[model samples]
Target: MTERKEINVLNENVARIEQEQPIGISVLGPGAADWEFWLTSAGFKLANQEDADVILWVDPEAKDFPAIAKDPRCIVVGNSKTNALCQQKKITYVKDVNDGEGIQRQLEEFGRKTRETLENPTLAKSRSLTVPPALSPQRPEKKHGIRLQRGLIKRHLPPDAPLEDPKGELREEFREESGPLSRRKDIIAALPSLGEDERRLKQYIQEKSEGEYRVLEVAESYADLIRAAEKGFFEVILVHRELPGLERNLVENLKLLREKAPGTRIILIERQSDDFSAMYKGHLDVIDLEWQVIPELPGHLVSLLKGQYERQPENHVVFKWEDERKPVTSLPSVRTSVLSPALIAYHSAGGGVGKSTGATQMGFVFAEMGYKTLIIELDTEKPSLLRAVGAAEDCPGLAAWNHSDFISERTAIEAIRRTSRQVHGLYVLPVGPISPKKVVLPFHLEGLNGGEEENVDPCQQAAVFYSAALKEFQIVIVDTNNSCVDPPVFMALKMAKRVFYVMEATKVFLDSAEAHIEQAYDLGIQLSNYRIILNKCTANDLLSLRTITQTLEIPVSLQVPLDVEGYRLAAHQGKPYKPKTKKGISPWGEFCQNVLQDLEVPITTSQAKKPSLRNWLLGWKKKS
Candidate 1:
């Protein structure tokens, strides 16, 4: 029995090595399912069929094959509905690679040469099969393996799907979260031994990463590790190589992470005196004690991690209209072209005339064209500009400890994100998450009370939020939803360098416009800072727009033709519509640009401000 088992194992290995050839093999349709299962189950390399000696076409119904002719290795298997796709190619037949006795029988009959016989291996070899006698159950139990016995797994496949055979869950799990459950076993099993051997290493790191830089405990699983790397989580990622179960899948997954998330830095885990030459190809930070003269791996790790901890991609807006693109918001902000320190105010009398949309267009364009712009969403009601720019993630809000004063400024700036990548140089950070709307108070806690005053408070807080964000930005656009209760909204209106009152050209819109204008006027807001933006306006409604602006103290800033296609596409895909041409473009952007030009903010690079990453990281690092 032992000799037979040894010969069988040798035969299987020889068959695999001899038959296998370098190639990129893709088993689309039903075959992908089996390919993944078999490859993963057997720890096989998924060689590309393009460089292979064979193309194993598995499905029966795919389209006719493209060009190419007779080849010995093109084997089509199974009673597939996909054979039509291979009509143009030189086809051979293999009922199945996994077909039982038939495969061995055919190979034997053909007298296929064994590539080589492995008589000796370095492994601590043992052929010990222990079969435990079945113990009678204390009680006769109903079968719980009904699902597996019935072959119910295939029932989960999607209807008529592509690549359904190798549904990528195992491969995806492998690619996504460092691959399948088996790989998880490899990573964890590798750690227990390493920890047992490396005590001084951990202690050394603790000593070096002293002060504000301290080690945040080690990550155990791929998920826990990833969770640490997420926004506002732990900072450094350290890896150790003593893990024996490392697989190609693990390495590939890490590579995927590097591309999708470029900010993360990975530390190679190696012992203090291990040879470094073998690991250098990974192309990441190597903290091996074997090659370095540094003391205490833990302390050195702490030092390296201190510099890289807590990194978020600098908020940058890309402006790309079709092909031409560049970072626009980083540009030096001119005073409305020369209005210095002007407050941008927005207001509406009734709800929804594109106030948010107008704000988004202006804010994004200003940010894109090289002005440090922050568009603040102040409306807590129904959908507003936050939704348009995809900024209103949760009720378009900032997560405040309280409204009294935003707990010291860090909370607001840290919450911003570039909402959409519209062009070469544009970004959007949506409004704060709004869940279950109202800010509630506990019955016993009397320090904070729930009241109608909450409505006006957020509006008041917008200025504070805007001012703080502007410290790092050049232009800030504040969009306030029309609220009757808030006196602070009026104060915000009065403080504007320019305000866009977006309205339709209809009589109802005009009426709404008048009411909004009056509200701001009552608040003592300088009517001059406000401008009329006629959104969705037609050539026919030009008269009403002019009349409304003229009657009010405000002037018509822009009569924007309705651009539904680009804007709608942007919202749907979570992207932005990059506008073409500088003049008479988006109502907000063109208006904001005009405001900057009027304020004398420099437009061209000859007068543009220099790029500054110096503001982001080290004030005086060696690299700087």
Candidate 2:
């Protein structure tokens, strides 16, 4: 049994190697599928008769042959009669395959002979004449070969040139003297590894600048490069195309660099023969280099420096073999609106966690403090803002606007209704009953029938409404549904500038919050964009907060004291909570005040007022 297993393993390896061959083989005649399968399993790619590198005719009495079978590459595989017929036609013939081992040997010998014949001087010359020299004879060790060439270039440098400063202290001192705020150029070279290429480039820059340019930092790894860029330590970043971690994470690293150092110029150093169209799609300049021009690198550095000083519009510098200048097309400029509103979303892991309550109350506070605030109820499955703010359930609101024939800024503004006079500049756009019923279907399921002419994606419609709201309101607070998986809620979270993930102080709630956070991350939500808000907290909840912070590695930005009675009484009256003490201070009021402070909302002494005894007594009675 063991010997049989060994033979099976050997056959599998042979099949794999055969299938990986570049030139595929085709088998004709009876049992072709089985033969093809066996050939592929032994490691040979199968191709059509016309396109195959070799064709095997297996049928003994077959008269017709594919046009390609007439070529010397074709062979006949069968009994002795087939071999005799093949000799009459000057075609190669092999004994019929009776076992896997015999067939394997025949295929191996055929591949070796085919390769040798293809590599003949006459065949190679013809192939070379047709293909471009640049595309000819690609070697796996070319990258290392280029490195070696660079080393040779360094060895032949003029003896008069000063050795590069090992510590680069001169560059550091220059940077300190000029300062980051200075207009002088501070360059950083990020290479795959510290070698002759880096040393040669650094020397060239220093010699060409004659004290003008400073190599601020040299990074050898992706992490170091990103760290330096994030710190904004340099004005120009020179990236070596062969940098470690670049091939796998090129797009990610480039995006991060663009974001971290928007003002800094990025120059990608690449081989002159490389196709860099993909790299050009990003915000980077390409500097094409050749081995022959390694000695003249200083001249190129000086030209780049001159261009920088002159404020040239072109970002790329291409050096061709003929030393011809190539025109570079500039990337399009990004446009941004000046009046961008602050969009904040309040979300929770589960129901009854005071997410909507906090969002509405916060919006009210912002409005009362004189900022135009709009509180949007995005929970389509269960619309609650209408009930929370005591508005009529049938009121035309977000749903009506979404399903309207034409929605605009005017339509959005008209959809919102002013909250009670308690909060002056606040407006509420409730998720009306009709829209909720229409949009409550699972995201994966389709065919949502709203009372409109056409079906629209709930998330897309919400985005349009949100955009219009942004144009009318200074601050938009979105109250998302409990489930983070909801399409509308997920979209809101993505659009929000700041997301407040509200959670109750309990084991079950914490567990839900943890799961929600994981889901949010999977949806590409950045941890930096979200802050955990511990709501309904007691003295004992402090320990749990610490544990949560340590476990999730997220900061708890706000903790609201457990004010169940205050909240219940306020809810029963269908009104936002008011200060219960004489000094215009209560647990609920204090929490709101702290929230305002944390959000950086400006507060004036005039905004505060003395508490009303009637309201205070009513709340106290309700609590008792």
Candidate 3:
């Protein structure tokens, strides 16, 4: 019989066996113990061969073959060589003796055969299933176009088949033989809600484009359509107007798809009654053809989008939504209008001026006001931000960012989002487990810089980091090293919307402040953006506030008095310095509030506080 007829008979026999419950089975010969365990688990009860419905004769090629083959209930299972006796006797054979599935199928067949024999006893005595001559012990057995070795199947490749797939020629041959659209990269994704129309549209597009573009059937929802466009890199997307998300707002989702995949064209499919051309401003033509005329639509669309692709296989960038990162010969100037995240940089001309403390305190204040805030510690030499924030040092921060392949914006966002730990609504990312001498922020090393060491600039990487950080957070406060030559400080000063010049009221700090400001101005930081904070102020200081302002040429923003013991106490406790007092707010909080005012951020808290216990306990509550 042909393989197809055998498969059909096997399926019919299995279906017949499913109607009955577990049939009694008996085991004999070698491997009987293991077979008994498997048979019992398969819901077959053990019994003697005389009383059992079926006999599983394992290793029937042995001397016990004749004894088991005489029984009509026996199913011979093994790589048996019983001459021509078993075939002449008409016995059921299982070639792979150890295969559980094959054994189960043979058992089910026996069950059906026994049922049929009981229903018509004359049919069993008159005829028996004849084993094909090809399955005889003298002839080699073949199964499903593959040569059967002892009990296993082995495929033999053509003699001229290539051993290696160099240049992907072999893979291309396989793809070409598999289907017309198998190797096509330019996809045209269609939503599943198109129903029967989806098949017709796919056929039309394939007929018109001549298999240059493949139709990818995606999920029925608009959200999944966006994901398909993002990963599929399609040439065009067919979005149904009746999609679930479009009911909320059609224009918003179209704009989102445009942003997510600027390279792909979105063609909205709707009926003539549902017109959104005026709303979309004919940004792209909407497909409103009748059902009969849909075949002609693909021909015209194929011509218009023949070679125009927003993204290409060889011309892809790290950030598809943004332009490619070009090589820089000079320092990048800061953006004045669209400074994302309202970045504030805390810098000082020298150490021990409470720069980190000021940055932490300000971040805490912004976080308290319910703005998602992150404090990026750019001081790679001595990263004290983690210690001050009380988070563990063993974190994937700058070290992970440096070692990881942040080839796209999503990777950078996910790295920062997954690695950073939150503290009282404030997120703190450490420098790393082990502080490096310099942190390299190579976003896409090979693609952006062509794998050249000279192109791996720390300043450029800082810009990439900041660009991702802007999307993740609303308020970003950077704490930098004292040196102007440091990549973190220079980039922070240049990119920050507001820069706080933290220095003590001492003469040593005051004198160096002017030189640092001049160097920063030469580096593209405007002098107007500087907000000087006089830290560690003393009552008997020699330099007055007016003289200090004259020397620095920028007016002092705030004066924080000497608090060595208080700061030490806060540091020991591993928290920001927010003094608990009966008064409304502390001086540190007031300085943060002033900084917010400079940034033009509203000073409103997240939610109103509950009434105090004193108001309910006594009669001190205000009457409404």
Candidate 4:
């Protein structure tokens, strides 16, 4: 089957008239002087009525004007008689002319109309001819005619006759017959300076291709490069590493260029020995001057145009470095209190993955170590923290705060209820009486007012509350909903200094965890600030740690062993479980200690004490 070609004539005309060339406009009568000045300043060409695509009529009473005014392409400017005539004729009219803003508005309207006319021209009102047989205006008629004749000859050739590869032979013939001036490729070189190397490359390409490759030099300024690229005038863009104003913002500038000219090939010129060369090797072609000199550059450029280069590799890479040296020093050490509180948010891939449980347990650990910790139940959907801590279910908390207009520091502190006496120094903020079903409603539904309420984002209320809680507490732990796409969950992740992404060790949970982490990365969260915690892990599954780490590209900081019986007993009692230990630490206690150590929190002297043997023996007996 022969290859098919699709052409969009209207789009082609619009692009040519609006972008490549100035739009032609005609103005009539005495009051059109201002209109003519504005049109010329806005990139419109002043032309006579015979050649103009848009004609503006400003005169109230001009002879033989009815026929011209009836044309769909005519615009009637403000004039008493003209307005009445246009109204009667049911034609478009503008009523204001003296106001500067009005003139600008009319200019914009005219531009829009010009584009629309070019994009969807009516056969009866069209001022230009339809698209020609050849798609490109610059394509020679002789060349198109020759190609047509060649196609006809091939169709008539006998099926049994031996046939050469016509496409390959025709391409070779075109290359040999056409000189550099006839088939030159347009290239834009964005370099810092027009130095010897740049001039050499340009001269080499022109000489080697016999003038088939033309390089247009552009200043290294990003604004100039971007404007040129947006015009879509060049087939290739050559960017140097030292381009002016791009030293610190190269990646962002290149991203803009890529978006503007997606079809153009971008090549980065850098020294082969440069360390940064490897960083940009995969995103775009890297031309190393050490390996490929000026003479070979032209052929390489052609190869890229012909799609002969290797496919681009993954563009993102993480580099890791390790040092084995240990330092020896003898000096008095001073311990300084942390200046800012640590904000930790617990998020899971799905519900029922123990996000709240982990957050509450961690809060208790911090409190036991002498840190004034606050656990905010941000999961309005379920609001399980109150139930978990055995606090009053109807206590005023996040919901009440959301409904109130202003909250004083004293009042905000009072909203937090102390946990059971067993866990001292720990506070709990319940989600209040709001039903989980209606938690998704907009904050405006509550009708709360005053104190930055006008600037508050409904999705970011959790962040606002977290900020207020930080004023009186040293550590803030937020238990968020499972869905990463949830607004509250997203805000929690964005504001937290550290995040604990909790999940089970099963295949289903692992898949969900991978997707969740990927989505977080897409939202611009740094991977270093997040730690993956594999909950309910077993000893037998330790071998899968490597696979999980490789798949998610994040290290698992802690793995809590499965303890169904302990969790069940705690849930039944409506409180977090605290294991009793004697000679050695219990599995649950060991997990909590490891997490605290990873967070760099110093354990208190009270927590270092070992339990009595009598208690250990009693615990063993109960287990038996």
Candidate 5:
């Protein structure tokens, strides 16, 4: 009997080496999917055929070869006899496609050859397998080769000099260095502590430039930081992202620093694990250094001072219109229009569950009950709200948010009022018309154009939107991202008064739900705020309601049955599921009603009567 083996086990050494120097391989045709997990685990990036360092031809017996396969960099992996018969050279033959270890060894060897070929052409040419011709001749790109003309250089005095005032003559000769004093690039650092690490940083800088270029001061408090900034003409101000008091509002402090030190460049220093980029990364520089690599901070500062460091590219938002109108400086206080409006967020562990469906249906029911409701789409990855409502994706929605950092409560309400489409009486704030990949939440617009005020903190923006939304509507349903906990979803969880943890009534999804619920709690969301909503419950499902509730260790708030036909019918109409008769309510509606009663949400009478039979059938009535 043959021993069973786990496929695609990660090779740590290979993964580490690949991380240091990635190998871009393009796996072509048919069986490409088979190698994806293995390649990804081994830290190999899948690139396009044209840009790939190596081309992998999955189809062994293919007569018609892709144009890229003709390159010397292409490696054919298949049957030796078949490859030989096909007249291909430099083939890697693996007995079984499932043998991930064998494939890893071969690819590692090929990557070494590719690296050597680029490093030394003579060494690469002696080997049977060679890298692509284009990459083979060129050396690796220089990271820190360019050095700016900085600091001072001691000059060798000429043998002969003027007879009169030699010291004066020498002083006149080297006047350029003496004039303006050529300041030694002072720096002010504001870190969480001014302990041994801080002293060591100062010592390192002094040693690097002989005490000339060094940290002039270190601030331990927000007050000290602002004072340091205002007092010094420092070239660089390095502030910790999570500096004690600065955590409350980092951007506000950053702006203060920018104002205090006009020409000084501010750089935010953070721990490697921290990601403040999803928050405030506008026009400022940020560096994420490992805690162990704190000693290297001096070197990085020296490079910055020398103007040789390659800083991260700044994200610039270019507006479509040439209007030079300044953005809203600050958000206005939200006047209490509706007393404590219900803020509900719907989330799930994985996609393909009825998370969005549940949110929309609940919002629809609220709207029908004479409560003004707004369903905010927070699923940036793949927003389905617009499509679900039969509205054009190009309609103004989240795109309006790109305008300013501090959006007014009125502006938020106005943007939704003007851009949003209403179905029955439910208002939907749609995701903008663009590829989800290019869409950045909180801030950071990739290809989109806007004003200078871009990339505000996700939490800040969400707060702005939420406060604004609450002022206009009695019920705000936030349809969050499915599966992963992104920044938007995190903010949604924090902001929501009630969280609906939606999941399918299946073992696989139930397990996922348990994991996600734990994760939500780990992220500091209150367990008491969450309620499990079991969706797609079938009549003969293996697990009963009692079994599911017991398995998850949480009470199931609602168990929505599998209603594919009803969903399809609703989707076809670009609306939520409705009742068959005027006096009756759908199952989803009943679920919403029960939820409202449980939450103590007031249900008022609808202002408008049912549409005329002619209008209902023909849709002759115009939208309000």
Candidate 6:
């Protein structure tokens, strides 16, 4: 039977199954990009979905889908969940038949089988599916026509294999072909006395690029690859499984690339099957480019490219400013204007300073200003913002997880709720009570937690997890914890285009915040950041701000007085709290507006060097 006919029969069988049973279609993970891929490719229609008896569940991760199997009518699949289980010795599966003689072999075979299935109604409905090659790209092979044939492998694989045999022919083929057997044996029995003649594979390494095989080196670090990107190298970046000093800024590098190299294509390569794809799905055009171990060369170049890089092969075009080739290093040095710096940080200092309220309102301002925004409650322990906004929906975070029903672990982006606010583009993902014990980060790296100091370094850990996903949205606001000392808090802090130090109108608050600000600066944060917003200020705070600004020699960004009624109403409604009245700009709003103005690139004359408020105040005094 041909491959085409086989796939067709599968679709027909599925249709018949859905008609015969109470077929249900359930989504296991958040935003599986390829549901449409499977829906269209597999030839399933939604209108028919309601009537078709069987359930087709497209999950992002397969691990969360075990219970769905219990239904007997539903089949769940996602690369993440499926691959992880395969590694842990769960399911038995293979690819969609090998097309050794080009796609011609597979296509022809599919057509034949599909016709046979339709003609003979006796075939079992649950026919086995050959797994698609691994999600990672298959490496290229040398000089296409020739392939290594292990006779032992032939012994294990039957004419048309059915189910896997434990001690059967397949095991011997694996051992003899590339497993323990091959590694222990020498290349050939006949060779010169000298070792060079015997170590032929090593010789091929020197003349590597000349062979039909190709090299796929995953870049070592994000920074190294980003630096290479700044210089415009668009090849695959080699990344190491582990490294030091990589704990750096998140959005800054991506921001720089967007500014310098917009729409750059990045391919992620990992040493483990549990790679960083789903977590950073929206951020990259292709997440799992391919997978391989350290210091080991891949076997087939053709498989690697087809599996990975082929998905997104585009040459990027970056916007460049007109620069006359003149050395003006000594000319009055001026800074280039950049996009508005959005601040996404915990509002209150240590224990107080209105952290939740500050973040809550800032989220409102960002959305109102015509920017699509998403605010995640990284403040895992307190879980105030969700309740404050009535988004709590009366369920603990655990309530959202139908562990058995979910096929893949969904990201916060998947579980967010859209709010009914004037801010048309705002969305919220709230934090629930942290699992009493552990925090599971994206990419399955264990031991990172919040609500207190995190065990994993935030910036480094996030680079491995979050930063890649920032590409998906226009802007993402993270309402984090109060402890500036926490390394991972920098994970959110470093991603910020600007960081606001929210302090109360007291000498003590200012003093405490200065220390945190200093720590950020020392730990690779730029100093242009570090703006101060005095939250919940009173008349006394006005006096203190004045005295402190003069003593500290730093400008105060804004002064927001306490508004108990305005905040409490929205908090009770579980809606984002924003001032109803356009009522002359609160000091915080004005500061935010200024940031928006400054971020406008190629600063217009009117915007740069506008008369300072201090000067306007002086002029008013003179008039008086």
TM per candidate comes to 0.45, 0.39, 0.43, 0.39, 0.42, 0.36
lDDT of 5 by residue, 296-394 (tens): 244355545455466532223111211232222232222224655888899887677878878877876675554667888877766778667554445
lDDT by residue for model 2 (1-624), tens: 854654454454345444434446878755354355446434456788666657766543555443424565676765555566677766776653433344555765675455434444343334323224453333222100000111111122232332223552222111111221122355767654433344445545655555345554566656556644543234567776655566466655675565455435567665442455454444332211111112223335555654543333222422222232112222111111214467789998777888887887676555444455667776776666756654334444544443442254444433442111111224566665434354432323344474443555666655665676676566788998776667667778888878988887777877887888898899897767788888888887645777888867888877877777666655543455553332433344455566556656455212222335355344323321
Q: What C-alpha lDDT values do all the predictions have?
A: 0.41, 0.53, 0.57, 0.53, 0.57, 0.39
Worst 10 residues of 4 by lDDT: 143-152
Candidate 6's displacement at residue 168, Å, is: 89
* Best of the two (1, 4) by TM-score: 1
TM-score of candidate 4 against the unseen true structure? 0.39
Reference-based TM-score, model 5: 0.42
lDDT per residue, candidate 3, 509-616, as tens digits? 877897888788788778888888988888988789999988778989888877786676556544556333223234766777777777787554433223343433
Worst 10-residue lDDT window for candidate 6 reads 185-194
Output the better candidate (1/5) by TM-score.
1
TM-score of 1: 0.45
Clashes of each: 85, 6, 0, 2, 1, 60
Clashes of 1: 85
Can you rank all candidates by TM-score, best first?
Answer: 1, 3, 5, 4, 2, 6
Query: 526, model 1: CA deviation in Å?
Result: 1.5
Estimate, for each residue in 200-258, the C-alpha lDDT of model 4 and write its tens digit. 55555555444444454344455546644543234567765655555466655675565
- RMSD in angstroms, candidate 2? 31.2
Q: For model 2, what is the alpha-carbon lDDT of residue 606?
A: 21
List RMSD in Å for every model shown. 19.0, 31.2, 25.8, 32.4, 27.9, 24.9
Instruction: Look at candidate 4 and tell me the lDDT of residue 231.
Output: 30
After aligning candidate 4 to the native by TM-score, how far in Å is the CA of 336 from where it should be?
A: 16
lDDT at 63, model 4: 65
Clashes of 4: 2
